[model samples]
Target: MQQLLAVAIRDILPNKVRLAITRLCFFFNAICSKVLDPVKFDDLENEAVIILCQLEMYFPPAFFDIMVHLIVHLVREIKCCGPVYLRWMYPVERYMKILKGYTKNLHRPEASIVERYIAEEAVEFCSEYIKKAKPVGLPESRHDDRVGGKGSRGLHVITPSVEDLLQAHLYVLNNSNEVLPYIVQHQHLVKQSNPKMSKNWVLKNHNKTFSDWFKDKIFADENVSETLRKLAHGPKRNVITWQGYDINKYSFYTKPMLTVNSKHIR
Candidate 1:
């Protein structure tokens, strides 16, 4: 609608309903920002008042309730207090949502909420001293902060096959910094030896023999990280697999879990 009305509506004050909403949205975003300018507090409040006025033009009188009127005061609060994030309703609303979910006794909602809140707080406090216990909600893996992350939940240990172990070992070696120069040296020599070999063949050949070559070549030197030395030594057959993983704010699931979720959706 904004695109359609773009040519017809020239004034900054939105004539179209959708344009008014867009204007309000932009204004709302500016006020909600973490680092708001105190100098622009008046302008921000004025802008909000204008947006609310514009909204009144588009919406009904009933829509201009107390909640809608509250938008006009947000900038003043920010000016007196600090950033909106520090004083936002989001945390309280989310906590209230959790409390609402605790309503087993619908008639005695206050009682239920108080009881659950106390129990939850008690559990949270006790959890700190309860070593090796899974948390009541959102269980954290001790390995979550480990190098390269250790998945959020449902980690299973298994013994992998020799081929799998070899592939895993070579993969680690290929990506190692200390061993990279050796790999380049090996690749150069391989290329010199087999001039007719394709780039793919060179890579394949390098991968096939680089592990054993590096193990021998690197043992003479003892300056690399213990991790690099271990990678050179090769992985054992045993492995730990994750059903779900959280790495760098991204969540990954195993194929079976994905399949099950898809089936359930279908």
Candidate 2:
């Protein structure tokens, strides 16, 4: 019931973009999701061009909005900016709703908001000083032990963490395709180091940390390593270079034309 209400409110909101632009954004998001390496730049560019073409096709005849012009330069914007979220207002707007809820009194709304905010901050500060007190504004069930229990429908599967991936043998077996021959040679090296170790034991223990212990270990190319290193660090910032309108460009000056037949007009 709660989820349905939330969905209805979200759908009914006046914040929606045009259907064509929404579809284009969805495609762009799909491309971004699969970008694990720098090699996917060509694919990203192609998707961006498709979106620009879509914007041109679905452009309204009467409206010459700034957003439409921005859509045309989406590719350049993405190149300058990191991702869509950084440039999007959805998160900011959602937070604004929370801020709006802070207002209580009609006569002195600003004072009420400030008072509520200070009270919240004081409670949070007090929670830190109190022994074993749950953090203010957090639900009592937030850290409940029964969260992922048998009857609970919560997600229970635990994927390997970054530290685990750096130290796990199973990760190497699954991702060894990138450096297959090197992995095989590394297995031999592991065996030499611990001849009595069982295959299961070796598989669970061999990792990048173990590789570092070996004097001669197979490593990825410096460029590939650097690219992977950057991927691990994640996007830095959401900076976009706003494209300026060229006065001479056909799209900038020309308005969509509508023709009426004389016989139909009469």
Candidate 3:
């Protein structure tokens, strides 16, 4: 259902309708994650309600009745006791199905369940007492032939290719523009150490060489000024709070502004 809604909003639906509905669903999912504080929850609830009402006004009444009721109640429930998962019946429903599967005799299901459960528990307890004993229902030899050797674990480790290493190094350099001068100095030092070293070799080992040189610079306190420059520059805010109003020319106008603090903006 979540994936369907996401696909509809992101790909299928038009932007005018999709933007509003997507924002509402995004907040709903965020609330479900149970990470939001009271202030943030309140903000989300307000935005959700506004968006829901706008959607109801634009769409047919029949389309919203049940959904609106559920959304309102969900918001209220979240406000009262955090996320929905805390009070949801999904885990209980799963366990109930498991218990139902254990029944043998439909007429005397309770008795059958109790007997089977007790016998299973006893067998499990006894199995634990035996050294290197496998579980009761499992096969005696459970070796996974797909993994090749008997002792080999079925784990695939990924190693980055030379091109991947080069790309990663370039990405770091591009983002951290301040590191260029230091890299140039390091290259000069490398050239002095190995006069015959080719530019191709330096390019290939750029990431490793830069990392080693950077570490040395830190330990020797050579780039204290550069470090301080980096420390002084704070992280940029990615979020913008917008206030919408009706204009004469434009039906709706939204003015974007930065929030006072990160806590107030999602």
Ranking by TM-score: 1, 3, 2
Q: What digit string (tens of lDDT, one per residue) describes model 2 on residues 1-266? A: 32234344555434433544555555555434534334655675676566666656655655646765564465556567756556678789998887779998889988988899899999989877894766689556423443331212222334545555444443443364555555666677778889999997776566543444321332333445543433333332332221222222111222233583321210
Q: After superposition, how far is residue 107 of candidate 2 from its true place, in Å?
A: 5.1
Q: Name model 3 segments beyond 4 Å from true.
A: 1-4, 57-68, 104-116, 131-190, 193-198, 202-266
What shift in Å separates residue 94 of candidate 2 from its native position after superposition?
2.4
Go through the candidates in order and give the clash count of each. 0, 0, 0
TM-score of each: 0.50, 0.35, 0.46
Please give the lDDT score for candidate 3: 0.63
Q: List candidate 2 segments past 4 Å from native.
A: 1-23, 30-59, 86-88, 106-108, 131-266
Better of 1 and 3 by lDDT: 1
lDDT for each of the candidates? 0.76, 0.53, 0.63
Candidate 1, residues 1-266, lDDT tens digits: the string is: 33344445556544577667777667767876777777888988899888888888889898888998998898888777878777768889998899899889989999998999899999988877785666687757555545575466677898978788888887777777877888899999878889999999998998888888878866777786786677678877778777777665567775545445531211
lDDT of 1: 0.76
Candidate 3 at 60: error in angstroms?
A: 4.5
